[model samples]
Target: MRFPWGPGDVADLPTVGAGVDTLSDLSRSAEPPGVRLRTARAQARAFRAEFALTGTPDTVVTCDLVTLPYPTRFGLFRASRAIAPFLSITNRMLVIRWRDSDGRPRVLLFEPSDVELGRYTPYFDNLARKTPGVLERRMVREHGTVLGHLARLGIRPDDVDYLMFDHLHTQDLRRWLGTTAHQDDLDARPRAAFPRAKVVVQRDELAGMAELHPLQRPWYQPDTYRDVPPEAFLPIDGSIVLGPGVAVVKTPGHVFGNQSLVVNTSTGIWVSSENVIAAEALTPEHSRLPGIAKWARGWQQEVVLNANTIETTADQYNSAVLEKTLADRSQADPRFLQFFPSSELTGAWTNPGTTPTFSHGHITHGVQPV
Candidate 1:
C-alpha cells in the first residue's frame, strides 16, 4: 500500500522475500518450523548486511512512558517459580529523527503507550478490581509526557509525520487520532495526539481488534478504536520501510498484528519490540538469572518469549529468532543479543530474580534537530 505521506510505495522498496513478509505466510507455510526458521535467518543476515549500507537516522531516543507491575510467569514464559509474583515493566516511547529519501527531515514515534487508557485493559482492569489503588500506587511516572519530550527536542506535535507501535495492545486510538463520534466516558472531545501524523500499523492487527478472540481479549482494548476515523490509520500488510535505516517488519506470535522497529545506528542495528522482556531471554543459554538457562537447555529452546498467551507460540518463537538475526551483536556485551524490549524488565529489590544480566538502558545516537 502507498503511504499518502512520508516515504512512498513500500512495495517498490527491497524485501527479504514474499514468504517471510507476513504472519499468514509464516503460519500457513508448508516448510517445517526448523527449516523455515533457518531459511529466514539466512535471509535476515543478508538483509542486515544490505540494511547496514543505508544511512543512519539523525537521532534515536527512547523515553520512559510508565512502569507497572507485570506477571512474572508470562514475562519469563513460566520458566521459573522463584521470582516475585509481579515484576516492574517500564513501557517506553522510541522517537526517531531521520531524513527521508528526498532529504527532508521527518519524525517517527514508536510505541507511545497511553498510560491512562492502558489501565483499562482487561488484564489490568482485573488487577485493579482485586486491589484498588495498588496498581495505581505501584505505577511510576518519573519520565514526563511524549509531548514534553518532543518540546525539549524542539519538535511540535504537528512536526511528527509518522506514528507506529509494535502492536495495538492496550493502546487507545481515540485520543491519538481524533474520533468522529463523541466519547461520553472521557466527558470531553479528544483531538489527535499529533495533529498531522499518520499511524502506520499492521493491517491484520487492526482487523484483529475488530473482533478479538477470547485469548486476545484480555490484552487488547478494542473499544478504544470504536470512534477513531479510518482515514487516521495507514494499515499496511507485512513489512515496510519508512525511510533510511528504519523498517517495521511483521513479527507475529505475540499478537496477530505484532511488528518490530528496526533502525540502523552508528553503534549497529537495534530492534525494539516486546517479543522478549529481557535481553538474557534472547541468549538464554548464557543467562545468569535463575531458571532461564536451565529451562532453555532442558527444552532446547534458544529464546524465551515475553509470553502472555500461547495460542501462537511457535510463530512468536520464530519471530523472535528473526529479530535476533536482524539485530547486530551488542558492543557492550557480545553474549547478550541486541533486541531491546519495548517494555524492558527492570531489576529492583521489589522484584527478585527478574534483573537482566545485561541491559541496554537507553539508546542515544546523533542529535535531534534544534
Candidate 2:
C-alpha cells in the first residue's frame, strides 16, 4: 500500500545498522544528562567521519532521536490533582530499522517515553525545573524527529501489526480499559489501529493481578474476556508463546501482569522489549539497578512467584515464593546499595535491595541477549 516512509527501502538509511546500539550506549552511560549532550555531539561527529571515510555521500541515510515529555502528576508523598492541566513528566523513545530475513523491511521501537515519564514524573519534573540541560532538550528533539522519520518510512498508523505494549501505567491503563467493556472491542477497527496481531501477555501474571488488587481487576479483562480458559492464555510456564514468531515472558515485580515480548524479526533479528521499568527487579546486571528503590519495592509482593512452587499449581504459591525471593535478594545484594543499602524498606521511589530488575520479557532464567 506504499507506506509513508519508504517501507521497502531500508538500505537507503546509512545509520540504520548502528542506530539501536548507539541509542543503548547513549542511555547506559554514567554521564549526567548535562554532560551527555557533549557525548551526543561527539557521536554525531564520529558518524559523519565514518560516513565520509566510506565515501557514502549519496547514502541518503538519516537517524531520528526523540525525547517525548509525557504529561503526568508529580510528588511522592503528595498526590497531584486527578487531571493536571499542564504537562509534567519526561521519557524517551528509540526507533531503529533493518530488512528482515524474508527481505521484508522492519523497524525496532524501544524505551517508551510515556511509560518512563509516568513512573517517575516527580523526579523528572524536578530535574527539568532545576537544571534544564542540552541532553534533555536533545532527547525531546530527537524523539520528534524519529516520529517524523517513521511517518516517512511508510509506517502508517494501520501498518503497525503489533502494539506490543510492555506494561500499562496506571493512568494509561485507566484510559485504555475505560474506553471499552470487552478487551476484544479495543482490539478491533479504528480503536485497534494495529491489526492482525495477537495482544500477547503473560498468562500467570494477568491472573495474579486480578488476585492481588481490586483496582487492577478492570485491567485484567484482556486475558479473562477470551473464550478460552485461563490455561489457554498460558502457553508456557515461564513464557507464553503467542505465535510462531513471538513469545511473552513473565517479568514480574513491575506489575502483576507485566510481560515482555521476544519478537523474531523477518530479517533474523530477535528483539526483547525488556520492559525495563515494569520489570526492573528482574535484571541480573548490577549496573542497571534503578536509582529509586521504592519502585521495585511496591511491586515485589504482587509479581514474584516462588521457584520451588512453580511446578505445584503454576499459579498462587509460586507467586508468593517469587515475591519473597526478590525481597530477600534486594536486601542482601550489594549492587542495590544506592537504593536499598541498609535493608530499609522505603517509599515506592526508593529501592529496597533486590536482584533481577523486572520488566516486560525480562526473566532471570533463560534470557540470552540477542
Candidate 3:
C-alpha cells in the first residue's frame, strides 16, 4: 500500500475533488459568514452522502497517549463562565488498519507522537512555571507509548505506512523523523520511530514550522525540526483519501494547516479533530453543561470551537459545521454526533464544572491481527 508520491509530493495521492475544495473556498471567501456556513453544511451533506460510502477499515483503536489539564475557557470556547479554570483531558492516538482501493493492507498512525513534549510550548510552559500543583499532580501518563501499543498489537516500527497529526501543535518531530544534525535538546541521539513511514501533513503546516507568526509561535516546537531532513514529510493540500474508510480533510481556523480525520466504522462515520472538545459541542442544544447552551442560544451559534488559538474564527466555526454534517449520529446517545475530539475532555473530580455531557471514551472496531 505504498504511496507513489515521494516526500513533499502529493501528485499521486487520491483527492476528494471539488467537494473538499468548495468547502475550503467558501470558508475563505468574502461571502457572508452565515451564507457560507449554510452552504458548507449543504456541501458536506452532499459530500458524505455521495463520497463517504467507502468500506469500513479492518480495525480502528484509540490509544491513550497522555492526560493533562487544559484551560477550561479554551476547551469550551470561553462561552462558559464556569468556576473551573482547567479541564482534564486525554490526548489519544489512532491506530487504523485498512485496505486501499487496490485491496492492499495499510497501517496508519494518526496523532501518535510527541505529546509529552507539550510542556515546552509557551502556554503550557508558563502554566507549569506558575501553577502550584500542575507539574506534580495534573500532568500524568497512565497509558503506554505508541510504540508499546504497536508492539503489544504485534506491529513493528517499520510496519507503519504513514503518520500524521491533526495539526502541528506541541509536536517535536526529531524523535519521530530523526535529525540529520545532532540536537542537544533531545535526551538521546534522535532516530526515526517509524523508519519507513512518511509524515502525511498539510503543506501549510509544514511551511509554518519554519516561519511561524507571533500567535503561532507558542504552539509549535520548530527547533525540533531544525535538523530534520525535508524528505521526512509528505505534504498535501486540501483533502485526500488515504485508503478505504479513511480520509484527511482541511478544517482550518484552529491553526493555519489544521485537518480532521474522517473514517467509516461498523457503526457509522466519525470525524476527529481538536476543533470541538466535547461531542455536545456539535449539538449544544442538548447539552446540560452550565453556560454552554445558554451561550450558544444567546449568540445564536450552533458550533463551539476549541479556541486555544483562533487564527480564523469564522473558518473554525464553519469547519465544525462541516464535521457535524459529515459524521453520523451516535448510536449510544442519538443526541450526540460521532465527532471525537483528538484531545477530549474527561471527567475529573479535581477539575470541577468541566465534566462533559457526553464523552465517547474511545473507538474500537474489529480484531487486530495476532
Of candidates 3 and 2, the better by TM-score: 3
Instruction: Give Cα-based local distance difference scores for all models.
Output: 0.79, 0.30, 0.80
Best-fitting candidate, scored by lDDT? 3
For residue 139, model 1's alpha carbon misses the true position, in angstroms, by 5.1
Candidate 1 accuracy as lDDT: 0.79
TM-score of every candidate: 0.91, 0.33, 0.91
Residue lDDT tens for model 3, 1-370: 1222333443433322223443454546789987878887887887687546667889999888888888888889868767888888898999999876677778999999676666788778877788777454655556778888898888899889888899989887777788777767665677788888888887766656556788887787776666777677777777877777888888888987899999998888999999999999889998878898999999998988899888889888988999999999999999999998999888887777788889999998889667
Candidate 1 local lDDT, residue 366: 88
Candidate 2: minimum summed lDDT over ten consecutive residues — where? 337-346
lDDT of 1 by residue, 1-370 (tens): 2112222332332223123332234755788888878766876787788777767888998888787788899899867654488877888898898887778888899987667777898998888788656545755444667777778778888888888999877887677788776789998679887888888887677666666689988888767776776677777777766777888888888987788999998889999999999877889998888898999999999999988876588888988998998888899999987788999988767788777788888888887556
Backbone clash count, each prediction separately: 0, 48, 0
Question: Regarding TM-score, does 1 or 2 come out ahead?
Answer: 1
User: Which residues of candidate 3, in runs, are more than 4 Å off?
Assistant: 1-24, 133-135
Per-residue lDDT for 271-318 in model 2, tens only?
Answer: 233222122223223223333344335443222221211222222223
Question: How accurate locally is residue 309 in candidate 2, as Cα lDDT from 0 to 100?
Answer: 13
Shift of residue 13 alpha carbon in model 2, Å = 40
Q: Which 10-residue window in model 3 sums to the lowest lDDT?
A: 1-10
Q: Please state every model's RMSD to the true fold in angstroms.
A: 4.8, 17.9, 4.2
